[model samples]
Target chain A: MIVAQRKPFEEIMNMLKGYKKVLNVGCGTCVAVCLAGGEKEVTVLNTELDMARKLKDNPIKIDGITIERQCDREYLAELDSKVDDYEAVVSMACGVGVQFLAERFPQIPVYPMVDTSGLAANQAVGWYEERCRSCNQCVLGMTGGICPVTMCAKGIYNGPCGGTNNGSCEIDTEQPCAWFMIYERLERQGRLDNILELHAPVEWLDQTPRTLVQPGYKKVDPEDLV
Target chain B: MKSGSNLEKVLKAGHFAFTGELGPPRGTDAEEVRKKAAFLKGNVDAVNITDNQTAMVRMSSWAASLLIMQEGLEPNYQMVCRDRNRLAMQADILGASALGIRNMLCLSGDHQQFGDHPSAKGVFDIDSMQLIYMVKKMRDESKFLGGADIHEPPKMFIGAAANPFAEPFEWRVHRLAKKINAGVDFIQTQCIYNMDKFRKWVKQANDMGLTEKVYILAGVTPMKSIGMARYMKAKVPGMDVPDEIIKRLQGAGKGKVAAEGINIACEQIEEFKEMQGLAGVHLMAIEWEHKVPEIAEQAKVLPRPVIE
Candidate 1:
């Protein structure tokens, strides 16, 4: 899931200083499960902002709402009628959601309340660890299901560098060496030959902005309609 | 004559070779490199020029190698994968070759976190194994990594590092085999303080017949003090400094630590001379280059084999 953390309170407060009225929007997906930008978090942020602003001479009003997945257009359409009532929109969703909301409401200023970190697995109730880089090319099939792109400090292929010390990365003794784990897993499975094969340099498919279209769905060209 | 380099000739002639290391200055002081090279001249077969070792910025290995070459010493030009992509690596290889450098050591450099620039992004476009394969392609196949024909491909004596002391102890020898299969002509191991572990690792390689495919050079570094040994044991990655060596250094007492360190290094060199399947010793007198001559002389590897 796309893991994100709320931006520092001071930065968020500074972005909302000039506004007299604002709408705090939250997402019900990844951020919600991570306890970052869920419905309860929006209510808490709105109350704190209200109290903090009231303490100052310049007070502001905020309305909080949590929608089901802000990435989809259908969920976003529900905010169309009520969005114009606000002077600015504060999005507690991931970067993608903020951009989508801003695209829908072009007149109102949209500010991000959270920083999108990475695609991660929820290790525990409140802990998350990055598991994938979304590099568009996956080599997990050969790497014993451990993602070197996300695990190794250098993201090296072929094998462990000379920096593998006692099963930990050279960057930090606390971090496990990705290639060490790969070698051990492959050795256990009797597929050690997989690691022996040379892996070519990554193609960097994510170097440019990427857009995906489903196999059955073709992007319609406006020129064809014309 | 794959590279026709002095080191290659010495190893090919079945002579036990001796190589020394020269770390380029942190600044662009060519004289510092020459000064260090002076001690190694006629005392060692080749001098390894490190490239931003430990991720700290320093004079480039290519430039330092050329400087030492001007001092009439053969340079084992070292190249690390942490700072260059394929384009820069290929360009540097061609330039180094044009400058008359024959030996090149490929490595995956230390992580940038340990360097002066901790925030700098490391460009590991190719690992050490891939770098070896690429250099081999440029030399033997006369082709670039992209398969483009070169006008005059660099004929380098390809070298790679093997850390037999690192983790997954059983797999270290297998990793060496992988490097050999990648077309590495020579191997320089991590510094050996645990002789028993190193003996076992080398015996495994010898049993697998890997010693015949590639020349293995045992890496050795003299501990300047007891603190240095402890730092290497606790801090440095992949370093296997045994506690007994530290106890020995401490036993040397106050003012005699440096001499004791050199004495220990000389003893290791003596053992390396008799070890089967071991081709040579790469003495890395880090920051203490002046002592290399005495160490070589005491270890009885002096008057290095002159191959014509």
Candidate 2:
């Protein structure tokens, strides 16, 4: 799931403090499931703003609008007539949605209301823990389905490293050392001997690295992408 | 000044004031409601008598307000549009005026799904905005939002709610402005724990013209116990409890936590009272009734604002 944290209130306030007409736009895909932006959350925000403005002696005019998925242009196409109603749009979707909205409605400045944290999974109800860094590598197969690249503090490919003590990693006591989990899993599967074998070093991609590709068989799709 | 002008006086009071909430009983249990009103009197400026609070079936806000008034306490009647049409609301406004329940807080009411009766048909013929507009029309223009003339106009001090620390932060400020434009006279916010967030929201509200037109009351619910604190943070959708407060409450132990909770509440009230453009504080104690007095005392808010 796409994980995000709410933008600092001061930052958000500063960004929208100039506008009188505001549109709170919610996205119903990843941000919705993660509870960052949804119909319920949007309504909640609406109530808070309503109350705050009432105190300052300058009550504002606010409206709410939500789209199906902002990553796709087709969903945002529905906001055609509604965009002109407000002076500014407070986007509750991910960082992608904010950029898409900025590009689509260049006239009205779009501001992101949430800081896109990272990919994470729900730890429990209303609880989420960061799980992946989106390192653009898949080495879980060799590590018994437990990712060492993302889970390791040092990102050590073949390491218990001297920093490991007991079952925990050195950097954070909250985390279990990735190699320790791998060792236990291999022992349980009667594949402990594999630990002794040498494996080649990995070249991990950093940042949001993008790549283009061509098909080997039928390559006509290059023109279709445009 | 006439007692009828107390609403304006109450609003005019420097920010850091206190209000209380009273959820009316299931039936016409005047004894239970009177007992509650007695518990709240002299301790709070206005006691909010809920109208079908939690969306469960209960005594109406108008009756509850009159009953509380009979028990010698000012009542802020909570009205919801979930079960009433424009006609009932219009008539109900007249009925409330006849009973001398002048202070009313307007709401769209909780959805049926959230309450015990999920299958109960909702009668949201008009939302809170339309109802507020109608009330304004009757009182200000002797007409409703539709411009229809009314034989008996009603007088009310209208208030609404806000939830500032909700997850999707950006949308809340603008939505608040809409309610102010809808003609709300005052606003009572959702239970707030994150004061830092609230300060920022207030600035944003000021920018939106929300603070210019409406009086605001910051809502606060004291955590009576550590267990209750956990429940409020995790279960209460909009209540965002800081980790430090949780740790503090945890370290305070059982007997000490209640006192600690009350102390924290007092500190918040003290801060709220001094804020620029702040109107007041709305205290929702849930069932922890008697502690409100002690909290008010500790906060140094005594000789309460009387409708002199």
Candidate 3:
């Protein structure tokens, strides 16, 4: 799932500094699951802002609403009727939600309260490790399901760099070397030959800011293929 | 004929090559580089000019390399993927070659957290491996990364760092081989203290015939005190400091620790020379650059090879 964490409280306050009445919208999907910008987080932010504003003697009005998924246009439509009542909207969703909310209501100013980090999987309670880079071309099958593109510090397709020590990365001794894990996994699966195969240099330029259209669902643009 | 530097000639001639490290000053004092180069002038085949090693801001390696060249010492100019993107890196390579800087070492520098500016964003647009391949492409094919033609390409004897003590110890040799395949002409490994592990790694390289494919220079950092030994053992990443060596340093007491450190370094150098697939030693005396001559003399690499 997409992982995001809340901005610093000072930065959040600064974003809502000038606004007299603001609406804080939270996403119930990824952010909620990650305990970042969930419905509970929305209420907490609201209380903090209310108290902060009261202390400042500005006495600003703040409200919060949590949509099922801010990325979906249908879920965002629920806020359309009341969105105009607020001076500004603080989106506590991933980057997708902040931009989608802005596009849905162009008149109202939308700001992101949480910074979208990366695609991650929960390792333990309140702990998440990044697992994907969305490189468009996935090599998980070749690498024994480990994503070297996101795991390796260098993101080299071939093998580990000289920085691999003991099984950890040279960047930080605590972090495990991704290629080492890949090799071990492949060897355990009797597929160590995968390491012998050479991969061409990745074309990262063509893979970024990519848009995908599901066939038979969204209209496909022929020009996009070019 | 790439770079045609003295280090390249010595290694090509299969003479036990010796190189030293010169860390440029944090300030804009070119004399610091010259001073460090002077210490290593007659003792080493080449001297490496570090690029903000450990993520700390320092004088640019390209400028320092040019300065070291003026000191009559061939500079192995180092580049890190921490501050520069491919565009800047490509331009700097061309500029270094135009300025007669011969050798280049590519590295994915330490994270910014270790540096003065912890808030600084690391620009790892490409890793060191890709940087090597990119530079190799530009030099051999005379083409830019974007497939643009280069009228005159930079000719450099490329180098990269290896840490045999790093984990997944079984994969270290294969990792070195990967760098060699990526167009690294030579490799200078991380500071070595564990002779047993290094010998095993070198043996693995020899068995795979990777030793014949590329020159492997073992890195040696002479410890100054028992405190430095303890600090490296506890703090330094990828450093393998055996407890016995610590005991040896501790046994040396306060006054003799420096001399004891030199003895330990010399012992490692002796073992390194005998190790299969080892080409030479990259002496990183750190702030003790002046001790390099004495250390080199003791290591029996004093009469440095001179190549035209």
Worst 10 residues of 1 chain B by lDDT: B165-174
* Rank order (by lDDT, best first): 1, 3, 2
The weakest ten consecutive residues by lDDT in model 2 chain B span B1-10
Candidate 3, which segments miss by more than 4 Å at Cα? A123-127, A153-159, A162-165, A170-174, A197-199, A205-208, A217-226
Candidate 1 CA-lDDT value: 0.92
i-RMS, each model, one decimal: 1.2, 25.6, 3.0
Task: State how far residue B54 of model 2 sits from its true place (Å).
Answer: 1.5
Over B1-308, each residue of candidate 3 has an lDDT whose tens digit, in order, gives 77787889999988999999999999998877777787888999999989998889888998888898888888999998878988999999999999998899988787667788877877777878778889999999999988999999998999999988776687677777778888899999999988888888888889999999999999999989888999988777678999998999889876999999999999889988887788999999999999998999998887987766
Off by over 4 Å in 1: A221-226
Number of the top-ranking candidate, with TM-score as the measure: 1
Assess the local accuracy of residue B76 in candidate 3 as a C-alpha lDDT between 0 and 100. Answer: 94
**Residue B251, candidate 1: C-alpha displacement in angstroms:** 1.7
Q: What is the C-alpha RMSD of each candidate to the true structure, in Å?
A: 2.2, 25.0, 3.3
Candidate 2, A1-226: lDDT as tens digits: 8877667767876677778889888999888888888777778777777777777766667788888988777888888788888888888998888888877888988888888987878888678876677667776767787776667654545444333434666445567878778777876897755544433333436535565355665445523532
**Model 3, CA-based lDDT:** 0.87
Q: Write candidate 1's Cα lDDT for B202-280 as tens digits.
A: 9999999999999999999999999999999999888998889999999999899999999999899899999999999
